[model samples]
Target: MKRVLVADDASFMRQMIRDIIEPEGYEVVGEASDGVEVVEKFQELNPDVVMMDIVMPKRSGIDAVKSIVEKFPGSKVVMCSALGQEALVMEAIQAGAKDFIVKPFKPDSVVSTLGKVLEKDD
Candidate 1:
């Protein structure tokens, strides 16, 4: 199974994502509640993909993505943003995230987007 690192300041969001992806066969290897923890967890867990929230505490997800991509060029990051954060979403893609999902996630879209991110060549 593909391993995933879930990063979100909201515990409820993390739990919801875990619930959605776990049953779809993705192994949620670790979770991080802040941008700093996201990087730390990514290094420690070395997960196949990271589901990162854009508006995180300590550091922004875009910054975390930049750091992670600099350290691990092959890192696959998927940014999670709110409905109106179009600019931030684009910034995240430029920061090396493979894809993104808007907040209040739909299970099917999440799964499909993640699948595409995983399928892309590094």
Candidate 2:
């Protein structure tokens, strides 16, 4: 099973993601509520993928992505963003996020995106 690390400041969002992915055979290895915790948990858990919110506290998700990718070139990070944050999403992609899912997530899209990202070669 693929292991995922979920990072979102909102508790509900984190739980929502867990509810969506767990039944798909993905194990949620960890959760982080802030950018700094995201990076720390990522390094500690080394999950197969990271679902990171773009506008996190302590450090933006874009910055965290850069840090993780710099340290672990093969890191698979999928950014989470709200609507109208296209520019930030693009920046996150440039920062090395594998893909992105907009907020108010569609369950199918979330699962498919995670599947596709996991399928790619590191």
Candidate 3:
């Protein structure tokens, strides 16, 4: 089972992701809101995968990704973004995010994309 760190400002979104992924055998090692918490938790939890939201307070996802990827080169991060944030999403990938998931998430897309990201990392 892979450990995942879920980073989103919205409590509901975090819970929703936990609900979807945990049942599929992924352990949510940590949950965080905002960019600073994401970075802090990433260091503390050291999860295999990170489900990160792009638009966040304190540092923003792009900024956090850049710093996190630099420090944890082996980290596999998949960004979560609302629809129409294509530019930011591309920036996230450039910042070393393995992939991304759009908002209003579907269970299949979440599981499938996570699989692809983790597979590539492996």
Instruction: Name the best candidate (by lDDT).
Output: 2
List the candidate numbers ranked by lDDT, top first: 2, 1, 3
Runs off by more than 4 Å, candidate 1: none
Kindly give the stretch of ten consecutive residues in candidate 2 with the minimal lDDT sum. Answer: 34-43
TM-score (C-alpha) between model 3 and the true structure: 0.97
| Cα error of candidate 2 at position 15, Å | 0.1
Candidates in order have lDDT scores of 0.96, 0.97, 0.93
Which lDDT tens digits does candidate 3 get at residues 1-122?
99999999999999999999999999999998999999999999899999999989998999989989999997899999999999999999999888999999999999999988888834
Q: Which stretches of candidate 2 lie above 4 Å from their native place?
A: none
Residue-by-residue lDDT tens digits, candidate 1, 84-111: 9999999999999999998889999999
Clashing pairs in 3: none
Location of the lowest summed lDDT over 10 successive residues in candidate 1: 113-122
Worst 10 residues of 3 by lDDT: 113-122
